[model samples]
Every structure is written in structure tokens, then in C-alpha cells.
Target: MKIAVIGAGSWGTALSTVLADNNHDVVLWTRREEQAREINEERSNYKYLPGFTVPESIRATDSFAECVENTHVILLVVPTKAIRETVQRLLPFIGEDTTLIHASKGIEPGTSKRISEMIEEELGDKKVQSIVVLSGPSHAEEVCKRKPTTVTVSSETEEAAERVQELFMNEQFRVYTNHDLIGVEIGGALKNIIALGIGMNDGLGYGDNAKAALMTRGLAEIARLGVKLGANPLTFKGLSGLGDLIVTCTSQHSRNWRAGFKLGTGYELEDVLEEMGMVVEGVRTTKAVHELAKRLQVDMPITEALYDVLFNGKKPPEAAKQLMGRVRKNEEELASLFLGTGDSDRS
Candidate 1:
């Protein structure tokens, strides 16, 4: 199959390698012509995946038309903020019968729309056979090295989900299919926000107990919001939810965690972003989730605190204290919090 991977970032390049390893003809799309030339000429994308040699079969192109033209699948892996613009630009080239897959994990700011929702809105008259989401705890640095990795693929249709599962499955790379697109997407996007919070915890010289607490309570809030948005509560325990959260919060490879780590150490958000050299999704996701929580009336204390720190100039230490000082709850109230029973105190 001919596959087009839109956005040649670390994750996109890694997936392109996986498809190329599967012996599929892959076209990697990047905005920079120079990066395309480098991939074709050097067989290496040093900016995103340095020291990793791209497969000879996996080629790069700057032309959106060339990328999507005659492709069997289109993988959207751009940043959350760029999803609308990228899809709008690619709509002209996208075929009516193509399958759309997005591996990007983020919620749109202001609008608070998921990536797939954004895609459907931007698709216009172009009707696709299916829309799939590929997500998990796997990091690009490990994936590019062919390290053992497992991820879940989800879609509205079983056949379409299975097709995507077959497309990327291999010995080193494993894929699972799920029917809950809402659960999968919500898990993938919201975990980044928690990861950022834990990163801030680590930056503030906090210990494991604090991080473990944050992880536990953070997941409670994630499921709270996800359930309010119609996702299955059990999905939070799966690879995309709990799994992605662990990896993103613990690993140095995570840009979101790294960004939060910098912020935790007293650096401003803008300075942290400028130094990262790549998009740290959690910052924007924090804002989006905060707003969504308010609009939906979901109790997301961690998200709210992170938003305060990121956008409203709340210092990290103060934010931590504020979170720790919230009204205590009994086990029943805690159950209500995670279970979304609406019996807990809303104050």
C-alpha cells in the first residue's frame, strides 16, 4: 500500500519507518523543502530523529499534492494547533476513498475539539472510508530503534480498525484494535496534561509519593472529563490512558514532561518552549482541558492548577500547595469523583 505521512516530526518519521519496514511505499511530508532534500539525500532526518537512518524506501516530499496523491492511507501527525490548517490544505489532494489515521494527541484550544472532530470538519466534501486513531505509550526515540512497542488503533467501524491494525503490526511493533474511538482519543490527549503536571512535580524537588499521588488523582480527573465527553470509563486503564501517562510523565524522551520539568525549575513557559526546539503539546492541552472542564462542570483540579501555572502566572510551588490544600474527601467521595456519580462536593 502507498501511505502518506503528513508531518515529518519525530513520531511521523518513526511511523514512516515502521511502514517502510512493512515494505509499503511511504511518502513523508514536511513543510521545509530542505528537510525533504535531506531525507532523500542523506537518508537521515537529523532534526527529528538524529543518528537514525531512514529507510531507503521511505521518501520525503514537500508537495502536499504529491504526498496525498494515489495514497491508500493518510496519517496526520502534525501538532494540535496545526491540525485545522494542515487538513484544510490537504483536503484538495485527499481522495474520496482514502483512509484517514491520526497519531497526534491533543485537544484543540478554545474550541476544545478532538483531532478527529477537527478532521471531519475540515474534510469538507471529501468522504473517507474510515478515520482511525493510533496511539499508545510508545515513544518515537524507542520506536525508531525498532524497540518492542505496543499501541492501540480505534475507529467507528470494526473492519476499518482491523485494517489499520494489520497495516502497522509486526514483531517489533504490536497493534491492538478497539471500537471506542472516544475513549482512545480522550486517553491519548489528556494523558499529556497529567504528564506535564507530574513533570512540574519532579521539577519542584518533590518525591515519588507526590508524583504517585498526582498520577492517581490526575487519572481520576482525566476519566471524569472523559466520561462526561461520552468515553468509556474503563478505557482510562488501557494502554492509551494509563500507559501513555506513565511513559510521558517518567521518560526524558517526552517533550511535554521536559517542558514541565523546565517550568518546574523556575523557567517561564515561553523560555521553556523556546528552548525545547519542538512542540510541547501539554502546554496547549492544559489550556484546552482546563476550559473543557469548566464548560462541562467536571472537577479537574490538576488541570486547573496546571492552567494557572502555565497561563495565569501561578507559581509552581504555590500551585502545588493549592492542590494539596483542597478539601479532603472520604472514600465515598473519591469514588464519586472517579466514577462520575455527581455526589461529591462541587465546591
Candidate 2:
């Protein structure tokens, strides 16, 4: 099958390499003309995936028409903030039969809408036939080198999701299918926020116990917001949810965690972001999750506390203290929205 990856960043390039390795005809489209040239010429993207050459089967193009036209699948790997803008630009070139899979994993800040929502909104009249979302714990740095990893492919239509399963799932890369788009998408988007909090805890010299607590509470908060938004609460335990949270929150490979670690160590948000030289989806995602919680009246303490640190000028260590010092309430009380906890409010 022919595939077009719409972004030229790390994940995009890595995915393009995988498709090319599978012997599929792949076209990687980039907004930057120089980056496009680098992919086809240098066979490597130094800014994103360093020291690895992209497969020769993958062609690079600066023109959307050259990328999307006649492709069987178009993978959207732009950052969360760039999703809508990027998809809008692809409209004139996207054919109806093309299946779109968004690898981006964050909600829109003001809209609180998932990337799929933005895709459908952008492709309004065109009404693309199939849409799937690909997400998991896999990071580009590892995935590019062909590390064994697993992820989920979800679509409203089972057939559409399975179509994606055929395109990319392999021995090294395992794919699971789910009909719950909301659950998977929500899991992917919100886990980054928790990873940021985990980084803060580590940077402040917190121990494994603290990190474990953050992961647990972060899962609860993620489930609360996800359920409030119509996702299956059980999905939180699946690959996109719990699996992603574990990898991002604990792995040194995570960019969000590294950024949070810097923030915890006294660097400003801007400085950390600049030093990282890549998109930190969690920072923007915090705003979106905060807005969603407010709009839905969902009580996500960890999310709320992290939001205060990121946007409200609250210190990261102070945020951790605030979380611990909050009026101890029953976990079952708030989780009542999703899991029917039999535990009492005796905390």
C-alpha cells in the first residue's frame, strides 16, 4: 500500500522508515522545503532522529499533492497544536479513499477536542472515508532503531481500524484493535501531563515511592476526565492509557519528563522548551485538560495542580506538596464517575 506521512518530525520520519522497510511506497511531506530535501537526499533528519538513515523506499516531497495524491493511507504526525492547521493544508490534496491515521496525541487547548475531531472538522465537506488513531508508549528514538513496542489502532469503524492494522503491524511492532476512539484518544492525550508531573517529582529529588504515587494518582485523574468526556473507563487500563503513562512518566527517553525535570530544577518553561528543540505536547495539553476539567466539572487534582504550576505560576515542588496536603478525600468519591469503587471515604 502507498502511504504518505504528513509531518517530517521524529515520529513521522521513524514511521516513514518503518513503512519503507516493509517495502511500501512511502512519501513524506514536510512544510519546510529544506527538511524535505534532507529526507530524500541526506536520508536522515538530524534535527529529529539523529544518526539514523531513513529507508530509501521513502520519498520526500515538499508538495502536498505529491505526498497525498493517490496514497492509500496518510499518517498525520504533526504536534497537537499543528494538527488542524496541517490537516487543513492537506484538504485540497486528500482523496476520499485515503485512510488517515493521526499519530499526534493531545487535545486542542481551547476546544478540548481530540485530533480526530479536528481532522473531521477540517475535512468537512470532503468527508474522508476512514480515520484511525495510532498511539502507545513507543517513543521515536527507540522506534526508529526498531525496538520492540506495542500500540493500539482505534477507529469508530472496526473495519477502518483493522485496515491500519494491516498497514503497519509487524513482528517488531504489535497493533491491537479497539472500536473506542474516545477512550484511546483520551488516554494518549492526557498521559503526557502525568509524565510531566512525574518528571517534576524526580527533578526535585523525590524517590521511587513518590513517582509511583504520581503514576497512580495520575491514572485516576486521567480516568476521571476521560470518563467525563464519554470514554470507556476500562480503556484507561489498556495500552494507550496505563501503558503510555508508565513509559512516559518513568523513561528517561521522554521529552515531556525531561522538560518537567528541568522546570523542577529552576529552569523556566521557555528555556527548557528551547533547549529541548522539539515539541512538548504536555505543556499545551495541560491547558486543554484544565479547560476540559472546568467545563465538565471533573475533579482531576493532579491535573489541576500541574496546571497551576505550568500556567498559574505555582512552583512544581509546591504543587506536589499541594497535592499531598489536599483535604484527604475518598478515592471512590471522585472515581464514582467511572469505576464503582467499594472503598469508603475513610482517608
Candidate 3:
């Protein structure tokens, strides 16, 4: 199959390699001409995936039309913030029958829209109809090395999902299929916010017990928000939610985790972001989740605490104290989510 991977970032390049390794003709598109030249000429992306060589069959191009012209499957690997612009630009290039697989992980801040929505906005009601989300706990660092990793591809269209499952699922890369698009998307988006708070806790010198509590509570908050948005609560326990949270919180390879680690170690937000030299999806997701909780009226105490620490000038340890001092309630109290979102599920 001919595969087109948009975005020259680590994840994009890694997935392109997977396709190429499988003997699929792959064209990776980079917005920057220099990055495209490096991929096509030098056979490497030292700036993004250092120590990784581009496969000879995995070519690069700056031309979006050429990349998507005859492609069988396309992977949208750009940052969440760039999803709108990228898809809008790719509209004219999309074949009417093209099947899309979005690997971007984010929810739009104010609109609370996922990347798939961005795609739909661009494509409108075109006859070409396959859409799938591919996400998991796997880091690009591990995936680039062909380490064992598992992820899921979800689409309302089951045949499309299974087609993608057959495309990328190898011995080292396991793929699961699901029909819950909303659940998979929300699960992938919210975990990053928890990762930021986890980083802050580590910076405050919190022990494993505190980290575990934060994770447990964060998962609940994530599930609450997801359920309100019409997502299946079970998705939160799957690879895209709990699995992603664990990896993002604990893995040193995670930019969100490292960004949080720096903030936890007392660096200012600007300095930490500047030094990290990568997109920390969690920081942006944190702001969005805070607004979402208010809009939905969910009792997301951990999200609130983290938001205070991230935006309201609260110290990490102080934020911890605030959480500990809050009037505790039944862990299964479902009334909080019921208030605004009108979700019928009991806590």
C-alpha cells in the first residue's frame, strides 16, 4: 500500500519507517523544505529523530499533492494545534476515496474538538468516508527502535479500522480495533494534563505514594469528563487512557513528563518550555480540561488543583495541600457529573 505521513516529527517519521519496513511505498511530507531535503537526501532527520536513518523506501517530499495523490492510507501526525491548518491545506489533495488515519493527540482548547473533527471540517461530506484514530502508550523513542508496543485504531467504520489494523500491526507493534471514536479520542487527550501534574509532583519531591494517588485520581477525572462527552468509561482503562497516563507520567522519553519534571524542579514555564524544544501537549491540554470541567460542572478536584498550579500561581506543594484539605466526598459520587453534562450514569 502507498502511505502518506504528514508531519516530519518523531512520531510521523517513526510511523513512516514502520510502513517502509513492511515494504509499503511511503512518502513523508514535511512543511519545511530543508527537513524534506534532509529526509530525501541525507536519509536522516538529525533534528527530529536523531540516530535514526530514513529507510530508502520511505521517501520524503515537500509537495502535499504528490504525497497524497495516490496514497492508500494517510497518517495525520501533526501537532493538535496544527491539525486545522494542515487538514485545510490537504483538502484539495485528498482523493475522494482516501482513508485517513489520524495519530495526532489533542483536544482543541475552547471548542473541545478532536483532530477528527478538524478533518471532517475540511473534507465536509465527501464520498470518501474512512476515518480512524491510532493512539496508545507507545512513545516515538521506543517505537522508532521497533521495541514492542501496542496501540489501538478506532473508527465508527469497522471495516476501515480493521484495514488499518492489518496495515501497521506487526510482531513488535500490536494493534487493537474499536468502534468508540469519542472514547479513544478523549482518553488520548486528557492523559497529558495528568502527566503535567505528575511532573509537578515529582518536582515537589513527592514519593511514589503521592504519584500513585495523583494517577488514580487523574484517571477518575479523565473518565468523568469522557463519560460526559458521550464516551465509554471503559475506554479510560484501555491502552489510550490509563496506559498512556502511566507512560507519560513515568517515562523519561515523554516530553510532557520531562516538561513537568522541569517545572517541578522550580523552572518557570517559559524557561521550561523553551528548553524542552518540543510541543508539550499536556500544558495546552491542561488549560482546555480546566475549562471543560467548568463547562461540564464535573468535580475534577485534581484538574482544578493542577490548573491552579499551572495558571493561578499556586505552588506545587501548596496545591497538594489544597487537594488534601478539600471537603472529601464519596469516591463514587456521580452527582457532580450529572449536574451539568446530563449524563445518566451513576458514580
Q: Top lDDT: which candidate number?
A: 1
lDDT of 3: 0.83
Reference-based TM-score, model 3: 0.93
**Candidate 2, residues 168-253: lDDT per residue as tens digits?**
87877888998889989999999999999889988998889999988987888887777767788788888999999999998988
Off by over 4 Å in 3: 333-347
Q: Candidate 1's error at 122, in angstroms?
A: 1.0
Residue-level lDDT tens digits of model 1 in 1-347: 89999999999999998999999999999999999999999998998888999889998999999998887699999998998898888777667588999999999988999999999998877888889999999999999999999999999999999999999999999999888898899999999998888889899989899999999887777777777788877778889888888898899999988888898999999999898889998888888888888888888889999999999999999999999899975545446645657643343
Query: How many residue pairs collide in each prediction?
Result: 0, 0, 1
- For candidate 3, write residues 146-248 as lDDT tens digits: 9999999999889989999989988889999978899899889888888888888887888799899889878878888788788877787889988988998
Which pairs of residues collide in candidate 2?
Answer: none
Q: State the C-alpha lDDT per candidate.
A: 0.89, 0.85, 0.83
CA shift at 145, candidate 3, in angstroms? Answer: 1.0
CA error at residue 147 for candidate 1, angstroms: 0.8
- Candidate 1 stretches with Cα past 4 Å from truth are 331-347
Q: Each prediction's TM-score against the native?
A: 0.96, 0.95, 0.93
Ordered by TM-score, highest first, the candidates read 1, 2, 3
